[model samples]
Target: MQAVNGRILIVDDDPIQRRLLEEAVKKFGYRSKSATNGAEAVRIMTGPEAGEIDLIILDMVMPELDGLGVLERLRSDKIPTPVIVQTAHGGIDTVVSVMNAGAQDFVVKPVAPERLNVSIRNLLKTSALEDEITRIRKHASGTLTFADIITRSSAMERVLDLGKRAASSNIPILIEGESGVGKEMIASAIQGSSDRRNKPLVTVNCGAIPDSLVESILFGHEKGAFTGAVDKHVGKFQEAHGGTLFLDEVGELPQDVQVKLLRALQEGEIDPIGARRPVKVDFRLISATNRRLIDQVKDGAFREDLYYRLNVFPIWIPPLRDRIEDIPALTRHFIARFAAEAGKPQVAGITPDALDLLQQYRWPGNIRQLENAVFRAVVLCDGVQLTAHDFPQVTSAMDYPAPSGVPSNSAPIATPAPHHAPAPHTPGTQISEPIQAEQPQSGFEHQAPFGFMRNLDHDGHVRKLADVEEEMIRAAITHYSGRMTEVAKRLGIGRSTLYRKLKEYGLDDNGKDAAA
Candidate 1:
């Protein structure tokens, strides 16, 4: 069992149930608090002493204020505490309703200690995961920094060394990387590690701002300088005095703005649009770009001098896919983080298959996409584990062949061999033995199989496989909007094979199926 780092709040009118839950949580090494009803729970959670409450287990059938009403009130009051609903009623409809009402999980009482522990453990794990992701983002955006930039890869290690040396200087720095890579993060880390760490680290998105306002936004304008100018305004440069200014997507800046920027960097002063004299200022410049500024300079779209100035120190952030080994760590980190923020304390971890799918994807959007995927999975997933079904969109987006070369449907079904001893044969008698099946020779046989399979009981009895293939096929066809080619790709089968299977299963709505 994992060490619990959060406080559990048990809300129930019955003293026995409250004590039962408190003791159960304490057995897992977690601290506990109790409330008699929804009103009391709300008061305790919102009061000055609410700092210790990390999660709540609310009884759904309480007197005066029921669980649903409490949920509504909490939502209305903007209390962010995570709540798991408990009730004696157990049914699909009631569970769905409570889940829809923002309850983390529904437990049928009398509460099983193991079930409660599973819920609480998963939630805390997810909370920690999300916190770490947010911390990474904040660290990348200049809010936090440490010695986390080191890398084992020689190329990245060299880059880290260079970044460290650059951080010690006051010269302007440029970071270049692909979209979604942590260029801005590296820039922030540099600022945080520099002597100017105490001062503000102002960031400006050059690509997001309008071209017309680019100059005026970076260099302040005097009153009456323009028609809309009501008073003298200070620009980002002036605001960043004695601090660090980060220009994200610096390659998008106009050539004219680049020229003025070059002048400011060289002279350490800026002349307002209508001002007669230039004002001296001191600040470090950190710029990032997904585009190649050297190419932009060669194309006459960027100032050569400005490029050289910003290039005095350079660093590049690698994409997430290049560091595939780090996916497990990153996934765990993000899951814990978002779980805490959403207040869902019962989500434990991703299933092994789900984690495999995550690691296999190319991650075109890099860490941002991974974080969003985990967030979506955590919210939509049921139970303690996140399954592949929870991330249907992600699985559907990937176009890789199934791990086994065989088609998804044709994949061999698994049934446990009987444990009983082989039947005895008469000595020296002409006896025939049941034909022994040939073992699979492929390397894939050594690895666990993918796709749906029949469940087995503890006593080793084979259970019927759920017949959802038709529904899955229909959904796949509808998802592709009746495009056979797309549906085949998503299902990881050839078009001809998909058509054959659809016809065999009577999944095709049209009278005729696609030609082989």
Candidate 2:
């Protein structure tokens, strides 16, 4: 059964341990698979089941391959699959090595089912949040006509519908979304399709302009307007007379500049610097902001009246994740466009499997990011179509799992693995299907998916996770009213482990009572 939470890949040469792990993971609602050894795990992870495998459990010591060896290989290839290394007795040093090599977590020999499951749940939760945040944070770019907006998603079609309607009038249009959902593209489309199409379409990035020059840039300046006034100049508003002026990132405009902008919009004119009289200007306003100006107005950063003026027609562009239905068409369009530009006759299109991964992958960068990724892949294309391996940035970014329980502000400690052979990619595999335990690759053959993390501090000191772990345990105990079970649940640890940690950290209230 496919897991509603996610899938797990268990790697151990020992059949008993593998079976035990499989049952434990399944008991926790995760679908799982087993690899006889580390080699098989690498193949499955880098091959067709690449996208499907969410987490991996590997034995530290195996026949031909070991857990540390596998971790090294993965780091070299930059695969971000969260790994839990289960080690044998007296393997603290090796476990430390595993942690330094970028393993998300490690389990000592005689693994308790609850402890292992707790780690898995935390990693999955963290990974999901990271993907969601990244998808919403990164921005998108470029300009094109409405006809160039290729999308099959109904959500996006509605965006287009509203944009086209707003374009017909001179009312200010506010296009919004998380960065990179193509706000600028919609702005361009509106400008292109609007009645002002024949007029010059001028654009300005409000956030990029220096605060001191914002007013002068928006409204023309005369000679001797200021110390740096070399010659009289027409600002964006005056230059775009009878045309459309697109102000991107308009939320960044300073309050002073906003007031001037309001006057320009309301009176249909501007006061040029050093001018004896106000200058009459006629330009259609098309402003765009990624942030909610409503919130800005509430916070007093934006003027309410000005916001209402600019928000006559508001169009929200959903992030790429919301309209993933457009991935295939967008992919095809990108492949063809980039290929022809590069004069690569070999580039035909994307494979069904590759397209699946693309769609499955969260697009933090949106269409602009997709365009860049496809262009890069096309340049690296050895086959007739773009393959998964060609888009390492996408795959690596997608597969990087965020381990839960990490503080929101804490950076994950990642260490670069020493030189190790990379994991070999398998052919003829699909991510959604069960991974067959295939023959192990001869040796470590490929680099980590992302280059392994570097030794962060001088002397490449390993972070003492024990200190952080103890602090967290104490914090949990204080916050949870000394309820061991609740603390364990919150921290993604088994009750026994929580008790052990409490005793180890001298925070065990029960143990204190017993001593008394």
- Model 2, stretches more than 4 Å misplaced? 1-145, 401-516
- Candidate 2 lDDT tens digits, 1-516: 121345689999988887888888766655688899889988998886766677888788887778888888898998887888888754667767889988888888797887886677566544544443342232122223564566667677677777777777787776766567777667777777776665677889998999998988989799998998989989999888988888998999999888989999999889999999998998888888766564466468888778877866666566676577777656765665666678885675565556767777666567888889989999999976678888998676556332233221121233332233223323211001111123111111221111122221223344367755655565555444455677689999899887777677675443232233
The global C-alpha lDDT for each of the candidates, from Candidate 1 onward, is: 0.68, 0.68
TM-score of 1: 0.54
Q: For residue 127, give model 2's deviation from the true position in Å.
A: 38
Tens-digit lDDT track of model 1 for 410-486: 22333432243223222222122212222111111111122323233224453443334554565555434456787
Give the TM-score (vs. native) of candidate 2.
Answer: 0.52
Candidate 1: clashing residue pairs, number: 20
